[model samples]
Target: MLIDLHKATLLVIDVQDKLVPAMADPQGILARIRWLLQVATELGLPTVISEQYPKGLGATATALTDAAPQAIVVEKLQFSCVAAECLPESLLAHEQVVVCGMETHVCVLQTVLELLALGKEVFVVEDAVASRTPASREAGLRRMRDAGAQVVNREMVVFECLRGASHPRFRHISKTFLVGEQP
Candidate 1:
């Protein structure tokens, strides 16, 4: 199913500061994620960010927080964010979720599966998720797909969300968040 921003939210999973630098190509991942937040904001979609054990791992990366100032930052001991207080309730009205973040195998994968089971249309940005080890990251992507989450490329999601140039914020979103186009 196509994700409608009016019916969607962006759930960034565990892109904590302390943990992020260790992931491969961390900056590239967060930059794309930050762009997603900008586009989501222009579309007026809400955002939720979760940090797994923030005390130990540190809060979310500074750039992400800056990009999504109004976004809710959830601190959770549970690997899956559906267990976090207020988050599930806040997301109750949202039927579709666009997810991106770190440690793909452990937290990101588990969260995607749980969210899917809860009946949300989960769209995971493949390029924006990672694990310290490439093997686990690859495994997580496969597992999330196996559990029925839609594995989508970044440009596909952006264009789908934009729908057309007639969209009111089209030029602004394109100018601010659009990265280099691929072939």
Candidate 2:
């Protein structure tokens, strides 16, 4: 199924400063997420960011904060963001949710599951999320897929949201964010 850009919202889950270094390929994950956030901004999509527990986990990484300055940042102790009741009604109104963040096995996995249960067409950006162990990350991806979330990569989302090369922002987004990157 195609992700309808008009009905989509981006959910940036728990990419906290203290937690990022422990994840596999921290830099690469952050880069993809930043690129996704940039595309979301250019497309005028609303973004909701969640911090697992700022007091303990640290704030959202500076890179992400700079990338999505206008994103609604919610701090919560719940692993599943839905359970935190932090997502604004405006964001929840969107039928499609694209999730990207840290600890794929924990926060990302739970959030995707709950979003799916809520009837939202959820897409997890695989390359934009990571876990400290490859085993956990793979398991989380499998579980999310088994539970009904469409597992996608960042590039697929970017182009899908753009729809076609003829889109007005297509050239700009491609050049600025997707350059030298393979899908």
Candidate 3:
């Protein structure tokens, strides 16, 4: 199913300052997530940032916060945002969720599972998530897909949201964000 911008919320899970340096392709993943956040903002989509125990992991990356300054930030101890019960009502009010973050095998995977269980349509942005090792990242992506979450890339999410070139933001988005991207 296409990701309906009106019904979807972007959930950035634990892309914290301390945790990011330990992930594989940390900079690349952050770039993708940052791009997604910027596009989400331009499209006027709601976004939620989840930090796992900020005292330890630190807060969401500075770049991400700057990209979507209006995003709601939630702090949690549980790997799964649902289990932590820390998700704000604003996030829960959405029917579909587009997710990206660090440590794909742990927090990202767990959150995807629980969100799926809750009957929410979950989309895991593969290129926007990673673990310290490539193996773990692959495992996490496989598990998430096996569990029924749609596995997609950042560009896919953006295009799905735009739906078509006729969309008012399409040309601007293409020139601003999709210029160098490959289908």
> Which regions of candidate 1 fall more than 4 Å away from where they truly are?
85-88, 179-183
Q: Tens-digit lDDT track for model 1 on 1-183?
A: 887767888888999889988988877778878777766777777889998888999999998899898898888998888765437566756898888898889888888888888899999989878789899999999999988999997666777777889988888777766745631
lDDT of each: 0.83, 0.90, 0.92
lDDT of 2 at 83: 89
lDDT of 2 at 125: 89
Question: In model 3, which residue pairs have backbone atoms overlapping below 3 Å?
Answer: none
lDDT of 3 at 98: 95
Q: Rank the candidates by TM-score, best first.
A: 3, 2, 1
What's the TM-score of every candidate structure?
Answer: 0.92, 0.96, 0.96
Candidate 3: tens digits of C-alpha lDDT, residues 1-183 = 889999999999999999999987788878888989999999998999999999987999999999999999999999999999988887788999999997899999999999999999999998899899999999999999999999998888999999999999999999998887632
**TM-score, candidate number 1:** 0.92
- Of 2 and 3, the candidate ranking higher by lDDT: 3
lDDT of 1 at 13: 92
Output the TM-score of candidate 3.
0.96
Sum up the clashes in candidate 3: 0
